[model samples]
Target chain A: MAAQTGESASTVLVCGEVRTCLLPTTQALDRRGAAQLLRLRADMYVRVSERPIMHVLSPETLTGVDCRLPASDGSRTRAVGTVIGRAALTEGRLLQTTSYFGLPAVGPDTRRPWGQYLVRPGIVEPFGMLPRKATAAGVLQGARRGELDTGTIAEGLAAQLCRHELLDRRAPFASAPTRLRWVALRTGGDRPAALTNFTLAEDGLRTVKLRLPPDVPASAAAGLCEDLALHDWLLTHVQRMLDDHPFDRADDSRSLAALRPAVTHLLHLWMPRAHVDGALAHLWDTLEAAPGFTRQWQNLVQRIRDQLTLLDLAQCRRAASSKGCEE
Target chain B: MPERVFRESTAEPRTRAVPLAHLSLELGHLYMEDFQLGPKRLGEHFAEVRIWADAVRARAARRVKRPRISTCFLIDDYFTRFSTPDEVIPTVLEEAGRAGLTIDYLARESGCAVADGVALAESVAHRLVESPPPGSYGFRPPASRTGWLTNGSRSPASPPRTDRGRTDWEPPVETAARNHSIFMDVELWSDDKNGQRVWSCSFLAAVWQLARLGLLRHLGEPVLVPREQDVAALPPDWDRLPPLIKVSATKAAFSAYRTCTLVPHHFLPVENAVRLVLDQVDVDTAALAQVAKRSADEGMPVPPEVAQRATYVFYEEPGDPIEDGKH
Candidate 1:
């Protein structure tokens, strides 16, 4: 038998994609509004966390998948199960949708009854033995024709939420949505979860690789990746705002107008590892040390603050000079 | 340590677990035609179902030492309303009693669509996640939008080749077919003359099956809760009848870990459509897990797939000797 016929709790691989974008609303939503907006399932409650930040999470939903597993070495492996997806809104400003599924090393040769798969949500079992490393690499690199595509699922969910009546569909700024494709391979419990690689590809696509402890579930790994995605997006977005050179104008008034949304909407959303599982939270330390997500964010934030200060001084001087002329 | 452990009710949702039996055996379905044929026809139907019910009980006994099995009867009040519940209930119960069968639960088919103000059918419809076709890279419009759920890839929308160079005809192919295909596309719902969405019989059947499997939940609460009203108090109006009533004195639960249905041979097409719909529904995972855990604790683990957990016996329709001969 190519695949085993019973339940297996240990996950061999986890693959996911996260799509992050500013909530397309003129005004940020309050806790109550956020709840209404993220109500994806009428029968399930939308989780709202008040402390740390106003983070709202929609109930996990499943999308059934019965397709070829993406293998970088070009091997054809069929997998059948459901991929789980959930939408999260941070501080009612940033919206993110994550689509993910864990894979076991082996599965039954034929697709079992759908009810069996339904019971094990977010698990996509492959026929026979799973090519773990190649599949992981395949997820990060990209899916081929007829291969499972988590990015599209994530993007589709984000689009669906954006189209919700609660949202005005009018973003405060013109910024592209960021896509983070991630893969986590199981490692022994002796080794704690660690971030192995982070790559920023073209066209808003970022990839992260991690070695997660067996005890840490795929959902935790997904949570860690989502945190990384949100922070990285904040840095990228603010850097682009800095590049726009709102201060290039003769007077900094226009610059202040241009940057108000960032100060109002995006800056405070940079709290990293806030809601991530403690077991996998330390993975952020590696990114903080090297590329320094916090360091870059702090710099942009200071620059924005200085610009606001400079803008204030200019206005004061102009008022003083006008008063002198009147005397 | 902080003095307070903050909590949000929405954040920590709970699923109310339903008491589960080892098997929920459906005795038979009553339709308007069967009612018009009178009590003798109902007696004959129950007699045929009695033989299969015994077989189902024997099968359940093999799985567990002491199997808790419940029998349910569904009366068709949705598609075509017949006599009032007051008239229908007594006669149906008497016939089943004559055949030495006891129906623990009596349910109306309309109850599957909407039970106690909960739109069970629409909620289940929203939960439908279409099985991805071979080349379903992702983000195809949901199958629910077209009001049809299919098991395979439908032929392309393009018509036959023409002078203008349109594409040629293609055949629909089932996703899991080995040698050949038996493609099925079942309609989930359609608009009525008044433009109100009418849930299809097959779709409601799928919902009924999910309820029997103890999988339907509304806002983390159990749906289709059987009212403990006395059967003798059944109302003259079908509208006033409870969706489900505990008719028997036995303590067996209405829902179960698995279900075995004894239906008539002519209803085979409808049941097959039910399977097609059930295969695609993404049921509440928490409820599914509860059943899995409870069943495992009892030393009778169910198959993972919701559809696989259901078994059926398609006997010839009672008093249809000519139809049996033709077959």
Candidate 2:
């Protein structure tokens, strides 16, 4: 696998995007159905684990691309090779598709035949020397037309899985899916993997940039991002579930009714770093230190619980008053 | 790190290895029109294909020591079934024999769609990774809406309704163009009269290419596995024949590192579509790794790309004397 493609061809830059959403099934697929749904290839294993959640990760697949590198400095560098897309099911309630690839610092000047890239699965080799920093910024900033955008490839798989007949097409709630685009630049200099910048881009796009130890597997970086993305998605959903509701302004019970799904489907899914490889667990510490993921999550959790308590008290008062009037 | 805390046994991947050949030479393909044109047309088709098949064998020999080669033919029992195996198999074998060509494996086209209870076509459809044109920008292309696979960016379609947009014509652009665009979009499947999904000829051809290239698999098992049938006599019906019948005692594996199909000129577009579909597919990673390791160890390293492994020689279709009679 390209992940172990030696130090010389060791990833100079590792970047990926993950799309997370509630699986569009009226009822979330059970462990059995989740395993079946993620069987993208029969020859590959659909890894199912019950350690944390009934999680299922489909065998990783590759998509070949030969297009302009999405460079922030707008250098017209062309990259050629495959991008890896893996579908993951968390507790059979949420589906996340992550499309990712690593870049070597330099590659052949000309595009090799496609088989050359297939053997190297997820390695997207750039023509000539790769400007690692600029390329990383460019990808994180965004891709223009014809640029190699890993997020689009990720979205393609997510959309495809959502359309399967196995799904009832009726999501439990009408919530926008979140896109988390992450780029990890190899910190060749002595620096343990550190989360650099995590930006919440417009339209549910979250971009996380990391400086990782060169020796860490690119997949470990992706796993870290997926963990961050899943928790981030949970926060986003809960925030939306309580947005501008007149919980304090009115005696209406609709706000409480709307927030109930948040308690049921999402509250328990904030287990950040649950599936993240232990080696990369320290990266979550960086997140917790600054814009603390758990800090904001706990705040949101407290607010929701407080609101629910208020609603319950109001409902009891209203019932008691109504009964006395009727007597 | 004296002791490990916890480990889940299920989160592992394993790829079963399949036997491989240096080359898979497709003798030719027969469709309803070819079958309707009858045995004489079939004879002429094989005669034209025989020359190309010999050339491919020679090329394979030059590349590798004792290059294992397998020859196969596909019969279109999917799109429009004209005759049964009882009527068709004997003549096909006889014609190929007269042309001094041997088809080690005889496969039904429908088998590419569904063989031995596996939805192989649907599996491949899930694998279609589109060649992203410049400026893809994370926008998931609407492949689901059209069921079409294109080689490059399509002309901006006339907005679905008049109220939504104005009529402005845009030229379709090929992503890999040098000076001019030869953009092609292939429709892989459509609904029939009864609303049952029908896999298109081009899509099935793409799956056939994957099978020949030794890329198609379902659940760690080889797909379209050749079933040896002693040809005492042809089966009573088309359904009676095994999806893939091994007609020869040849030792070469049916799947190979590379494929060369002797298709008629009319199939050029279909094969082109196959290229588009194959280009985007991220084939199973573990399986891909095995192929790469096996080939490298064998000292006959194959191209890493699934699409590049496929080759085609399109000849003029044999004119139907029956059509001449109609004229």
Candidate 3:
């Protein structure tokens, strides 16, 4: 463990990542099942709030880690601290876990008691002065074998929850899960919350790096990232469905087979920024302006709708012709 | 946001607070090996333990004018079933009296794993979050393979840790090492002949830390609540006994804001592993908040990290008149 100086206790570079996956049950959990499924700890009930969406938030949990800080310049500064993790269920269909922690500007020269690290639940104190720009770049670039990477922690947590006995080990659709690794480099209160970068990486991983005003807690960054990851997952999943049928009007059965899950499970799930806090909502705006998350989602939905329409007409003609023959 | 909001009873989250004390000081933990060594071991253990127990009480006194302090002892019945509690209780009490120590609560180690129809150990196991080694970029370590916890990235020690057929060996790297590594990987549990899994001594000690810290809850209620030990004679079997037995009248609660443990050097490694487990456990937020609030209100706040709330003094095992308790 890095010797925790007073400076590290008050963090400077706050970074974390969120991973989103499908609930493994054959059917999406109802409100009751969602609560039961997300009761990660036996002691506390899952936080189920109903308004925009019936959302469930599990109690926060911790994972301890000691590893080198991912410095862009390759200056080796080891860090030791606990990363905080929690799960959120959206409408009982999407399960997401955000595993995140932060590093302070500088730390004490010597390591202290482990209890000291536990007290700062989600904050991983760096051993020496932090290189904010380089470390953030390194984190965005992803871990290089031994650097501390929170996305794995987030994914690990989601995987653990998926294995719960409560889950039937069946998913309604066979869609790939995604991890959105995020970092919020704290630049003090003078600036507005601005997104630095959001990139779709290979192998079901997404990276988001941003700058936040001091007012927005690192958790807000996580919330924004979870929202992004969840919606991106929905898009990626539905896109795969559309990918199956390229409007080959002759092939009705295969198209319908592939598109059925998209309509049944995912179409209505597209309500972006439903749960993101107001402070960090603008980050979604940047994505909306550029490639536009909702635009791509709308296009995918249209493709699904267009294919389903073709399938609908094909079914109607067969019924009418059969009726005429009977007459 | 849309209209027609709905809320379910089970969905709302709540954390019922446990009775709190200023300090929860553990007198000692005695394993079967120590027990077989006989009453002489108990005398030496208690004699050495009494020294630090008083120092903790005095420290607590400075925090609160009359600190609500509770002292407890743990007997290992989980790893190996030994003499019946009927025989064990008398000797323990007798030895405690010899040291002028009044044990407020007597607990069984098995209870830390399960008590009162709750699978406490499994619940805790589900809560384990791996500490991220540096370069942890979103890739989760496979923790379940060996049921082990480590302070750093593991070396390619065994087939389970490294890929099959890869002969290249990698040194286990401690994330927080000054230079060279003091790598420690602890096995948390293994399956027995009946295929029922058994938690290792290190993992149980971690659970013991949570219990002592009063961070454990089962269905929003405290686990291992002390039952008054009115029955002078304990049951013939360990299974018949309640997990926690209160031995003497005291205003203090079993759970507290801080915990201090006195253990043998063998436990030094075990305690280190316990810290590894503890660093990642997400305790109930409401419980954490309550402790934070109370501690702040009392004008002596605790470290925000859960693991930091615990303290341990690892000394050489009982043999000679114990010199200044070793590290």
Best by TM-score: 1
Q: What does candidate 2's lDDT look like per residue over B71-166, in tens digits?
A: 998888887887788777778888899789888999998898888889998887766555555444445556846788776777765634356575
For model 1, chain A alone compared with the true chain A gives a TM-score of 0.95
Tens-digit lDDT string for candidate 3 (A6-81): 3222777877777788888888888788877777666556677666677888766666666787877988887777
RMSD of candidate 1 to true structure, Å: 4.0
Instruction: Tell me the tens digit of each residue's lDDT in model 1 across A1-327.
Output: 001112224678889999999999988999999988888888788888887888888887777777888988888889988788889999999999999988999898986656567666788989999999889989998888778999878988898889989888888888899999999888876877789999999999999999877777788788888899999899999999888774756456678877887898888887888888777777889998998889989999999998888889888999999999999
User: By DockQ, highest first, what's the ranking?
Assistant: 1, 3, 2
Judged by lDDT, which candidate is best? 1
What value does the lDDT take at residue B252 in candidate 1?
Answer: 85
How should the candidates be ordered by lDDT, best one leading? 1, 2, 3
Of the pair 1 and 3, which is ahead by lDDT?
1
| Every model: iRMSD | 4.8, 3.9, 5.8
- Which residue pairs show collisions in model 1? A3-A107, A43-B219, A115-B304, A115-B305, A115-B306, A116-B304, A116-B305, A116-B306
Among incorrect, acceptable, medium and high, the docking class of model 2 is acceptable
Residue B327 shift from truth in candidate 1, angstroms: 23
Q: What is the DockQ of each candidate?
A: 0.44, 0.25, 0.28
TM-score of each candidate structure, all chains considered together? 0.92, 0.76, 0.74
lDDT for each residue of candidate 2 in A192-311, tens digit (9 for 90 to 100): 778888888889999998887877778778888888888888888888777756676755568767887888788877788888867788788988988888999999999999988888
TM-score of 1: 0.92
